[model samples]
Target: MLCAYTKLGMMVDARHLFDSMGERNSMSWTTMVAGYANIGDMKAAKEFYDLMNENNAVAWVSMIAGYGKCGEVGTARRVFDEVVVPDASSWAAMESCYAQKDMRQKLLSYIQANEENVDGTDATVWGFFIRCL
Candidate 1:
Protein backbone atom coordinates (compact mmCIF):
# COMPACT_ATOMS: atom_id res chain seq x y z
CA MET A 1 0.00 0.00 0.00
CA LEU A 2 2.75 2.42 0.84
CA CYS A 3 4.57 1.55 -2.32
CA ALA A 4 1.39 1.86 -4.33
CA TYR A 5 0.67 5.32 -2.98
CA THR A 6 4.26 6.43 -3.51
CA LYS A 7 4.32 5.10 -7.05
CA LEU A 8 1.13 6.97 -7.67
CA GLY A 9 2.90 10.13 -6.39
CA MET A 10 0.85 10.21 -3.22
CA MET A 11 3.73 10.69 -0.82
CA VAL A 12 1.60 12.18 1.89
CA ASP A 13 -0.62 9.13 1.85
CA ALA A 14 2.37 6.85 1.63
CA ARG A 15 3.95 8.44 4.67
CA HIS A 16 0.74 8.06 6.61
CA LEU A 17 0.57 4.37 5.76
CA PHE A 18 4.25 3.87 6.44
CA ASP A 19 3.96 5.47 9.85
CA SER A 20 1.06 3.21 10.72
CA MET A 21 3.09 0.05 10.16
CA GLY A 22 3.91 -1.79 13.41
CA GLU A 23 7.05 -3.37 12.02
CA ARG A 24 9.31 -2.42 9.16
CA ASN A 25 11.88 -4.26 7.15
CA SER A 26 14.57 -3.36 4.63
CA MET A 27 12.03 -3.57 1.84
CA SER A 28 9.79 -1.05 3.56
CA TRP A 29 12.61 1.43 4.05
CA THR A 30 14.07 0.89 0.58
CA THR A 31 10.64 1.44 -0.90
CA MET A 32 10.37 4.88 0.65
CA VAL A 33 13.92 5.76 -0.39
CA ALA A 34 13.30 4.64 -3.96
CA GLY A 35 9.96 6.39 -4.06
CA TYR A 36 11.39 9.71 -2.98
CA ALA A 37 14.29 9.31 -5.37
CA ASN A 38 11.95 8.49 -8.25
CA ILE A 39 10.24 11.79 -7.62
CA GLY A 40 13.57 13.70 -7.54
CA ASP A 41 13.15 14.25 -3.84
CA MET A 42 16.78 13.46 -3.05
CA LYS A 43 16.65 15.18 0.32
CA ALA A 44 13.80 12.98 1.45
CA ALA A 45 15.50 9.96 -0.04
CA LYS A 46 18.74 10.69 1.79
CA GLU A 47 16.89 11.25 5.03
CA PHE A 48 15.15 7.91 4.77
CA TYR A 49 18.35 6.19 3.68
CA ASP A 50 20.25 7.64 6.65
CA LEU A 51 17.56 6.38 9.01
CA MET A 52 18.25 2.84 7.87
CA ASN A 53 20.58 0.89 10.15
CA GLU A 54 21.75 -1.40 7.37
CA ASN A 55 21.92 -1.12 3.59
CA ASN A 56 22.24 -3.56 0.76
CA ALA A 57 23.19 -2.93 -2.86
CA VAL A 58 19.60 -2.23 -3.78
CA ALA A 59 19.32 0.55 -1.20
CA TRP A 60 22.62 2.18 -2.17
CA VAL A 61 21.94 1.80 -5.87
CA SER A 62 18.61 3.50 -5.40
CA MET A 63 20.35 6.63 -4.14
CA ILE A 64 23.09 6.62 -6.79
CA ALA A 65 20.71 6.11 -9.68
CA GLY A 66 18.21 8.50 -8.17
CA TYR A 67 20.74 11.30 -8.11
CA GLY A 68 21.68 10.58 -11.69
CA LYS A 69 18.05 10.43 -12.73
CA CYS A 70 17.57 13.77 -11.05
CA GLY A 71 20.52 15.21 -13.02
CA GLU A 72 22.62 15.43 -9.90
CA VAL A 73 25.32 13.28 -11.45
CA GLY A 74 28.06 14.75 -9.31
CA THR A 75 26.26 13.61 -6.20
CA ALA A 76 25.81 10.17 -7.66
CA ARG A 77 29.48 10.01 -8.58
CA ARG A 78 30.44 11.18 -5.12
CA VAL A 79 28.35 8.43 -3.55
CA PHE A 80 30.05 5.90 -5.76
CA ASP A 81 33.51 7.26 -4.89
CA GLU A 82 32.80 7.15 -1.17
CA VAL A 83 32.66 3.38 -1.19
CA VAL A 84 36.18 2.26 -0.28
CA VAL A 85 36.01 -0.72 -2.55
CA PRO A 86 32.89 -0.74 -4.66
CA ASP A 87 31.84 -4.15 -5.84
CA ALA A 88 31.02 -4.94 -9.44
CA SER A 89 27.33 -4.32 -9.00
CA SER A 90 27.83 -0.91 -7.40
CA TRP A 91 30.23 0.27 -10.11
CA ALA A 92 27.95 -1.07 -12.83
CA ALA A 93 24.89 0.67 -11.45
CA MET A 94 26.40 4.17 -11.39
CA GLU A 95 28.31 3.70 -14.64
CA SER A 96 25.12 2.58 -16.32
CA CYS A 97 23.41 5.71 -15.16
CA TYR A 98 26.20 7.82 -16.60
CA ALA A 99 25.86 5.96 -19.85
CA GLN A 100 22.16 6.67 -19.90
CA LYS A 101 22.89 10.32 -19.33
CA ASP A 102 25.47 10.34 -22.16
CA MET A 103 28.04 11.17 -19.54
CA ARG A 104 30.56 8.75 -20.94
CA GLN A 105 33.41 11.17 -20.44
CA LYS A 106 32.60 11.31 -16.76
CA LEU A 107 32.44 7.54 -16.60
CA LEU A 108 35.76 7.25 -18.34
CA SER A 109 37.21 9.73 -15.92
CA TYR A 110 36.00 7.59 -13.05
CA ILE A 111 37.50 4.51 -14.64
CA GLN A 112 40.81 6.31 -14.86
CA ALA A 113 40.72 7.17 -11.16
CA ASN A 114 39.55 3.73 -10.03
CA GLU A 115 41.21 1.40 -12.49
CA GLU A 116 42.68 -0.74 -9.73
CA ASN A 117 39.28 -1.57 -8.33
CA VAL A 118 37.55 -2.04 -11.69
CA ASP A 119 39.38 -5.20 -12.72
CA GLY A 120 40.79 -3.83 -15.92
CA THR A 121 41.78 -7.30 -17.11
CA ASP A 122 38.32 -8.79 -16.73
CA ALA A 123 36.49 -9.34 -19.98
CA THR A 124 33.16 -8.79 -18.26
CA VAL A 125 34.26 -5.40 -17.02
CA TRP A 126 35.41 -4.54 -20.51
CA GLY A 127 32.04 -5.73 -21.76
CA PHE A 128 30.32 -3.29 -19.40
CA PHE A 129 32.44 -0.41 -20.68
CA ILE A 130 31.72 -1.34 -24.28
CA ARG A 131 28.03 -1.60 -23.57
CA CYS A 132 28.08 1.78 -21.89
CA LEU A 133 29.24 3.42 -25.09
Candidate 2:
Protein backbone atom coordinates (compact mmCIF):
# COMPACT_ATOMS: atom_id res chain seq x y z
CA MET A 1 0.00 0.00 0.00
CA LEU A 2 2.76 2.37 0.90
CA CYS A 3 4.68 1.40 -2.19
CA ALA A 4 1.56 1.91 -4.20
CA TYR A 5 1.08 5.41 -2.81
CA THR A 6 4.71 6.25 -3.37
CA LYS A 7 4.70 4.97 -6.93
CA LEU A 8 1.73 7.18 -7.62
CA GLY A 9 3.57 10.21 -6.17
CA MET A 10 1.31 10.34 -3.15
CA MET A 11 4.07 10.93 -0.65
CA VAL A 12 1.86 12.44 1.98
CA ASP A 13 -0.25 9.31 2.09
CA ALA A 14 2.84 7.12 2.07
CA ARG A 15 4.43 9.05 4.91
CA HIS A 16 1.28 8.73 6.90
CA LEU A 17 1.33 5.00 6.48
CA PHE A 18 5.03 4.81 7.24
CA ASP A 19 4.58 6.75 10.45
CA SER A 20 1.79 4.47 11.52
CA MET A 21 3.82 1.30 11.17
CA GLY A 22 5.21 0.08 14.47
CA GLU A 23 7.87 -2.18 13.00
CA ARG A 24 9.55 -1.99 9.62
CA ASN A 25 11.51 -4.50 7.68
CA SER A 26 14.23 -3.52 5.27
CA MET A 27 11.75 -3.57 2.43
CA SER A 28 9.48 -1.14 4.23
CA TRP A 29 12.41 1.11 5.05
CA THR A 30 13.67 0.84 1.51
CA THR A 31 10.22 1.74 0.24
CA MET A 32 10.32 4.96 2.24
CA VAL A 33 13.80 5.66 0.97
CA ALA A 34 12.67 5.15 -2.58
CA GLY A 35 9.56 7.16 -1.90
CA TYR A 36 11.57 10.15 -0.76
CA ALA A 37 13.92 9.77 -3.67
CA ASN A 38 11.10 9.53 -6.18
CA ILE A 39 9.59 12.67 -4.73
CA GLY A 40 12.91 14.52 -5.24
CA ASP A 41 13.56 14.75 -1.54
CA MET A 42 17.11 13.48 -1.45
CA LYS A 43 17.71 14.85 2.02
CA ALA A 44 14.86 12.77 3.39
CA ALA A 45 16.01 9.82 1.38
CA LYS A 46 19.53 10.13 2.75
CA GLU A 47 18.18 10.46 6.24
CA PHE A 48 16.24 7.20 5.88
CA TYR A 49 19.10 5.51 4.05
CA ASP A 50 21.55 6.36 6.80
CA LEU A 51 19.03 5.11 9.29
CA MET A 52 18.86 1.72 7.60
CA ASN A 53 20.17 -0.94 9.93
CA GLU A 54 21.66 -2.93 7.08
CA ASN A 55 22.52 -1.01 3.98
CA ASN A 56 22.08 -3.16 0.93
CA ALA A 57 23.02 -2.52 -2.67
CA VAL A 58 19.48 -1.41 -3.49
CA ALA A 59 19.52 1.17 -0.71
CA TRP A 60 22.91 2.48 -1.72
CA VAL A 61 21.87 2.67 -5.34
CA SER A 62 18.78 4.57 -4.29
CA MET A 63 20.94 7.33 -2.83
CA ILE A 64 23.31 7.23 -5.78
CA ALA A 65 20.50 7.57 -8.27
CA GLY A 66 18.61 10.08 -6.16
CA TYR A 67 21.61 12.35 -5.86
CA GLY A 68 22.17 12.04 -9.55
CA LYS A 69 18.55 12.77 -10.27
CA CYS A 70 18.87 15.92 -8.16
CA GLY A 71 21.95 17.01 -10.17
CA GLU A 72 24.36 16.32 -7.38
CA VAL A 73 26.70 14.25 -9.50
CA GLY A 74 29.70 14.90 -7.28
CA THR A 75 27.76 13.73 -4.26
CA ALA A 76 26.55 10.76 -6.27
CA ARG A 77 30.15 9.98 -7.12
CA ARG A 78 31.05 10.24 -3.47
CA VAL A 79 28.30 7.76 -2.64
CA PHE A 80 29.55 5.52 -5.40
CA ASP A 81 33.08 5.72 -4.07
CA GLU A 82 31.97 5.12 -0.50
CA VAL A 83 30.13 1.89 -1.29
CA VAL A 84 31.72 -1.01 0.50
CA VAL A 85 31.10 -3.54 -2.26
CA PRO A 86 29.56 -2.05 -5.34
CA ASP A 87 27.82 -4.45 -7.66
CA ALA A 88 27.17 -3.99 -11.35
CA SER A 89 23.98 -2.03 -10.64
CA SER A 90 25.94 0.51 -8.60
CA TRP A 91 28.39 1.14 -11.42
CA ALA A 92 25.57 1.33 -13.92
CA ALA A 93 23.75 3.87 -11.75
CA MET A 94 26.85 6.07 -11.65
CA GLU A 95 27.32 5.70 -15.38
CA SER A 96 23.70 6.62 -15.99
CA CYS A 97 24.14 9.64 -13.75
CA TYR A 98 27.10 10.89 -15.75
CA ALA A 99 25.34 10.20 -18.98
CA GLN A 100 22.21 12.01 -17.86
CA LYS A 101 24.35 14.99 -16.83
CA ASP A 102 26.00 14.80 -20.27
CA MET A 103 29.42 14.69 -18.68
CA ARG A 104 30.82 12.77 -21.60
CA GLN A 105 34.43 13.07 -20.52
CA LYS A 106 33.73 11.80 -17.04
CA LEU A 107 31.56 9.02 -18.39
CA LEU A 108 34.27 7.93 -20.78
CA SER A 109 36.87 8.06 -18.06
CA TYR A 110 34.69 6.02 -15.74
CA ILE A 111 33.98 3.46 -18.45
CA GLN A 112 37.66 3.15 -19.21
CA ALA A 113 38.53 2.77 -15.52
CA ASN A 114 35.93 0.09 -15.01
CA GLU A 115 36.43 -1.73 -18.27
CA GLU A 116 38.02 -4.63 -16.52
CA ASN A 117 35.89 -4.49 -13.39
CA VAL A 118 32.44 -4.16 -14.92
CA ASP A 119 30.25 -6.84 -16.31
CA GLY A 120 30.47 -6.43 -20.04
CA THR A 121 27.20 -8.22 -20.44
CA ASP A 122 25.28 -5.76 -18.31
CA ALA A 123 22.77 -4.08 -20.59
CA THR A 124 22.60 -0.79 -18.64
CA VAL A 125 26.33 -0.13 -18.91
CA TRP A 126 26.19 -1.13 -22.52
CA GLY A 127 23.39 1.37 -22.99
CA PHE A 128 25.51 4.03 -21.36
CA PHE A 129 28.34 3.23 -23.74
CA ILE A 130 25.97 3.45 -26.68
CA ARG A 131 24.61 6.77 -25.48
CA CYS A 132 28.13 8.12 -25.09
CA LEU A 133 29.00 7.31 -28.65
Q: Specify the highest-TM-score model's number.
A: 2
In candidate 1, stretches whose alpha carbon ends up further than 4 angstroms from where it belongs are: 84-89, 120-124, 131-133
- The C-alpha lDDT values of all candidates are 0.81, 0.84
Cα lDDT tens digits, model 2, 1-133, are 9889989989889889998999899998998888888778998898889898987788888888988899999999988987886677887788778878889678777777968766788787777777777
Candidate 1 is scored at a TM of 0.81
Over 4 Å off in model 2, which ranges?
114-133
> Which residue pairs in candidate 2 have backbone atoms (N, alpha carbon, C) closer than 3 angstroms, thus clashing?
none
Candidate with best lDDT: 2
lDDT of 1 at 115: 80
Per-residue lDDT over 1-133 for candidate 1, one digit per residue giving the tens place of the 0 to 100 score:
8889878878888888889999999999998988888888999999999999887677688889889888787889877776666767777778777887888777777777778787777675676667656
Worst window of 10 by summed lDDT in candidate 2? 110-119
